[model samples]
Target: MPNVIEALQPTLEGAAMRAVFALPQPLRRLIAGPPIRIDDQELALDAQLLLKLQKLTGQTGLSAETAAKARAGMARATKITAGSPVPGVVVAERSIPTDDGDLPARLYRPREVTETGPLLVFYHGGGWVIGDLDSHDDLCRFLAKHAGIRVLSVDYRLAPEYPFPAALDDALAAYHYAVDNAADLGSSSDAIAVGGDSAGGNLAAAVALRTTRAGEQKPVFQLLLYPAVDATRRRRSRELFGNGFLLTDHDMTWFMEQYSPQESTLADPRLSVLLADDHSDLPTAYVVTCGFDPLRDEGEAYAKALSDAGVPVVARRFPDLIHGFANIRPVGHRFEEALFEIVGTVRAALELHKG
Candidate 1:
């Protein structure tokens, strides 16, 4: 039956993915290289893979249809190249009903977690436009397995269709859902966290701010990975690393236009979280930034803001890497190292909660 086939798809795909990664590491490198250098930063081996991807998907322009198709192809390629799922991580697909609609989500749990534990409600990054649950599936699985925490990847509505508060709404909805139904999702309600990379990071920060303001049960921790905290993009890093990096200023402009067509809304705290009046009382945060990301300064600025507000904050910046480096598989040991560091941070944060 179609339903049976649909249900079996992830298993089949995951198995195939594992086999592909089982090949010799040298061979994998050969397939994904040779690396290119841009400015002072040497591009990762995955840059070649991205070039091939660009050829396959064309320019991706500003159109929704082109972007969607390109995103799908990129996700497929990422899965093939992302090595394999972390061993002993169990994945399941589920739909959480929101006031807007039934929001699809994927849940990842470590095999050791037979009882309730920490839960990370994650939003996938695509500049609020071009990502979904599948796009960041491998990262979620890696975090869940390595950090020994449950990860719920939400498929929030994308922009040029939903726009602005829509994605924010879905993100907040998912976080609340996790808080309310933590037991059902195999997590302790008190140990819930919210995190995301890039635009999803923006959403996570916004949700954390709003939750604190609402006098609600706030998330225990915040994990912001290269979040786009400033919609204005006026920082020196934006000009310094705006081009040649994996994400260009042109692409960022396109994404911004799609997400917030009105220039007036660009300064709104929900969109530009760094512009928020008060950062006091936010949860402890782990903020990651890449040297070659245009959004790097804003992310650091946010961390500084949180620290100034007396919120415990851990901020790490990778000087040799570009935007989206943490999610790319073909980037070699550097990528693995960065990812492991992130997972370790998550583990430590959860353990503190347990204590």
Candidate 2:
């Protein structure tokens, strides 16, 4: 990974292309105190985020250790700018026992809860290498508050250290724990769902598949936000948006290397849900994809697979945004709108299950 200065020092051709693709909002924000909103267009924050990320990456590089620090720092900054916590949501820390050890968890409960509210087991995204409960705390709070559902954010073990089956094991264990102990968490076991973004999204989908294969009680729903369904990275999106977007193809490869170094593991359904033999009889899915994200094609593909297998699925794409836009508050109203859309979908899905 290039340093901040090195990364931002693009070649003449690349610089020219960037200038052509850059949006005026980010440029305006650079000069002025706030972003100048023009017409509603896609790539609204592309230039802004891209520039910020380039500087951060340039300073920190993409080494595992540095990336972890950078991610932590960014999460802290995001929290500061995330404004106040959503009202009517109660948050509590939890320790969920897994086969390996005790996994840290955070429970977000809506104030207006009934005897049987829906529970969403959420996993945070960090390419299975970075991220934790803190990174996604705000998003979870918003979901719990606006979606009117309880959210259990699992802090699964990351890669290089734990690797492959570890995170998956943790995810599955957390799901089962939520199901068996749902009542204790003030949610109904039958109304439980699984959700996550990126690598976390992959884990959520894998858990759903594993549950289906085991003939266990399937989750009521699966909410995948820009999930990496294909570990093989064969999707065309990898080549298209793999460069300038927040998550690069190189970053994806780095993550895969850290998580599953062995090429043989690529085909494992737990690692690559898209390669699973059966997608039928899982659960209803709400898949979100970003047009500029390298994982977009695979996420959409997974959604299509679910729909083909007779599962009720809703796939929505935000053409203007990049990967991880949901967590970046600086992206402006588009981020809030997208987050609300996601929460709305979760609410509607849970309601349908209740009905």
Candidate 3:
């Protein structure tokens, strides 16, 4: 009976979440407390409720725990939030050849492919400390199913175990592996893109810049979801929405500390991609930021930097959403809607690139 209840947990949670989201916006806002307005942006009703639920349940963050424990906690949380895998997307276990042992990877392929179509090499976001392929599984599936593009989800080494340059180097290695094997992956070399949320987003941006300057195969596109572009400085968002917004500044500091313990390593452009000297002629990019996220300003700043550098970039801000919304789409109707919109944007961008 216990096992059965455990198995039915996601279903139960899903139903409850759906019921909450089904409520009228005003009701949700009322339940989540009065409208939360900051920086001239009002929090969306759904986002407010989600945060309220988290706070009520004492489910803020796991920053104070050991890396091992935090990782385990993250996995359990992913199970509840990921909901169910979408149908029609084929998932396969694969390995990315890297010097630091073969990294585990999951390839998400749409039922049909053009062989020369776009393929996004994705890194799961956990501030480079906690998340894994499983945490971002549903996201990969949705991207593949909705955008009609293949997704290569890489499980790069985490921090405090494999610090700073380790993840970045491994990410580059995985991207190189993808480039060399794009044909076998049912995608062309020119159609491959790099993407991730938060830490993963930081990796994608770094990888793109590295490949561009290092005379390697350049990626054609980038899909950065609230990337942590500059960890060196704090922007207004950090102070405004630092607490009760799902991703707290305390957690952010802890994550970065775990990723790069050595104080000297903080200034490296690979860790803070926004500090990189150049950002021109890299790849077409779609950068998504959340209005209530601490990392929002840094992400937008990076997007602006990319645009000023003459790169074709689209920067979208979900004014009512909070950070890490993509991973919680299962029960979050508003998040699901925003995600689909992002998928459509990706599809259109890829189509135009192919033209």
TM-score of each: 0.85, 0.85, 0.95
Q: What digit string (tens of lDDT, one per residue) describes model 3 on residues 151-180? A: 999999988988989999999999998899
> Against the hidden true structure, what lDDT does model 2 obtain?
0.80
What does candidate 2 score on TM?
0.85
Give the poorly placed runs of model 3, Cα more than 4 Å off: 1-14, 24-26
Ranking by TM-score: 3, 2, 1
Per-structure clash totals for the candidates: 0, 4, 0
Q: Candidate 1 on 1-355: residue-level lDDT in tens?
A: 9999865654565455445445586765675566555445665544444444444435332223356765765565465455555689889998988999989999999998898788999998888888788768878988898898899999999888888889999999999999989999998778899999998899999999999989998999999999998886588888887765667788788888888999999999999988889999999999999876788889999999999999999999876677776676433566777889889988998899789
Q: For candidate 1, what is the TM-score?
A: 0.85
Instruction: Report the C-alpha lDDT of model 2 over 1-355, residue by residue, as the tens digit.
Output: 5576553433332444345334476554563234323224346554344445455535322334455664665554454335456778889999999779999999998877756688999999988888889878888988898898899999999877888989999999999999999899988778889999999999999999999889998899999999999887667777877775668877888888888989999989999999899999999999999877788889999999999999899999887777887776433566788888889888988898889
Candidate 1: residue 108 lDDT (0-100): 95
Q: Higher-lDDT candidate among 2 and 3?
A: 3
Best by TM-score: 3
- Full-model lDDT for every candidate: 0.81, 0.80, 0.89
Model 3: weakest 10-residue lDDT segment is 9-18
Model 2 vs truth, CA RMSD: 7.0
Comparing 1 with 2 on lDDT, the higher-scoring candidate is: 1
* Superposed model 2: Cα runs more than 4 Å off: 1-41, 46-81
